[model samples]
Target: MKTIASTNSSAFGEPGIFRGQARFGSPMLSDYVWPLLEIRGQRPGPRLCVSAGVHVNEVSSIEAAIRLQKLFDPKAISGSVSIIPLVNQPALYKYSEYICPIDGKNINFTFPGSKGGTFSEVLCDAIMNEWCAGSDCYVDLHGGDLRENVSKFSIYQRTDDAGLEAMGRRMAMCFDAEIVVGLPKDHMQRPGRPPTGFARHGRLALMSEAGANGLLDESSISFHVEGVLNIARALGILDTPMSAFRNARVACNDYLWVETPVDGEFHAEIEPGMRVTKGQRLGAMRNLFGEEIAEITAPETGLVLWRMTHPSLPKGSSVLAVAVEETQVGQA
Candidate 1:
């Protein structure tokens, strides 16, 4: 891997693999450049980019990106795949969670950021304007932070373009995840959640999640790695016969969270991907004396997507979250 300096156009100009470091937009961090891996297949086709670590604490997704950077060969079927293993470089090194340490902003929400903006914004601007350019399809990898107990899932930010939305849904279901969902950008609007600005990029983008609590579990890592490969196969980015589509994928437009009204030690009786009916006791909030202070019940019948794995619960903490507002797209 030579320290080659190449633009995105030339990076994908010809059929080959290029690996190097690209400069970070932050002048304060003048000494650091983010790692970039570009692989252009032998045949001309779509350009797919896989990014991770916007929330630097998602260790498994980051590890999977690192593995994917080297997994592809130049002789693969068609198109190119760009791997950005680490996006929030400052937060990653400083051990920050969801937000960037330098700018105190969650890089997740700041899309198509500005050059004159904060550290997080500048980095985000590069991702949306530069890295995401010429990408036919984009996949952003993320997962639970240090305090979250998230199960695997994928969501494509719904767009007005019907074709793009359909492709995004296909991309979401092509992976190995517990479920998949499609919701408008206005549904949970925080700028844009899928790395690139959907309106600006005008391309297919989806977010996939696995792993949790900053743990580098191999199973989670494999989930992400296989997910990307499966997508590449389904999208014809790799040299495979392409039989990796997960035919059964559930969709939920909104989530119903089971929260505690008071601070107490929490006990969760359900895990992610389990089915629960309304009024079912999902967990309990107990006092220091081991008294059941409150019973956490499901407000709706749905699938459990995520739960609070930690026993310590603060006031208004969500013990378990169920995927409500569901639409059965296919059979499992």
Candidate 2:
């Protein structure tokens, strides 16, 4: 249930920020506009490329990207900031879930995009070549989609490049979330699997996720805004005080998704971020007649990070996720 929301069709048409569209050579996308905002600072420094709405119903990230346009002054900023508020414009237009509606492709899996590919591939290719080309910091903002709920966290990768890995960790910690999740770079670089948010850029790439259930929650939006600002300040893009990554209380080695094995209505007893012991009953699945069909329990003793918000669950759907195998990262 979202209390606040943008009353318009697209946030791009909002008054505060409007840079011309970044044209991709896609005839299928000729009818729509791909929103791009560039803010060049008076001073020279590192460039930052931030993208949101890779999953269209992740409204909080999209809203944060839109707000970032007017949050900083061009004169105070160093170098520039490139923001793509809504990457899946068609999906956003139709309120589609994770995949792009036009091509039914997950933008996350397509990186170094192919020019001669489908609409989704072409659009992502443009972004990869245009914004993620150089030594710039790339951030892919994401969160729970229309039916999912997520807590605040940041993700970095364990890439082969130590320098890039260190920078990614620092960037992930800048989000000031209690948890920082790490993924194997080999997994991201390996083909045939979901690439996990274009992290294979082989640079300072990370992800910030907050807000959930397709809501425009102010706190979640601010979480993203402040996190990006922290990174910008740390990278000298802004004049604000630089706050390096220091708030991570736990750094997990992996994040696990819990899939429902049966089709039923879900009843979750625990909210995200709750700490539960192994085998704790997190929830239960019931048929339409209210007969319990399955029991949902914590697979491990760790923090529950996210879950599906909608009650209806189909077998094999990712209904919950947990942060497991963690180590104490920072001071409490």
For residue 278, model 2's alpha carbon misses the true position, in angstroms, by: 3.2
For candidate 1, write residues 156-266 as lDDT tens digits.
Answer: 766667777777777777767776767644643455565236544666777888877889988778778887887888787776754454524677655556779999998
Off by more than 4 A, model 1: 1-14, 24-31, 199-201, 243-248, 256-258, 328-332
| Each candidate's clash count | 0, 0
What lDDT tens digits, residue by residue, belong to model 2 across residues 1-332? 00112343223323232365666545755666666776776577787888898898888998999998887776677777878798888876688887888889887766656778887777766666655556368788888788888878888777677787778777777896767877765566543122233455555667888988888999889889989998898788887885444444467766777888899999999988777777899999999999999999887777888888899989988778888745532313
* CA lDDT of each prediction against the hidden true structure: 0.75, 0.74
Stretches of candidate 2 above 4 Å error?
1-18, 26-31, 189-201, 242-249, 328-332
TM-score of each: 0.85, 0.85
Q: How accurate is candidate 2 locally (lDDT)?
A: 0.74
Q: In model 2, how large is the Cα lDDT of residue 19? A: 66
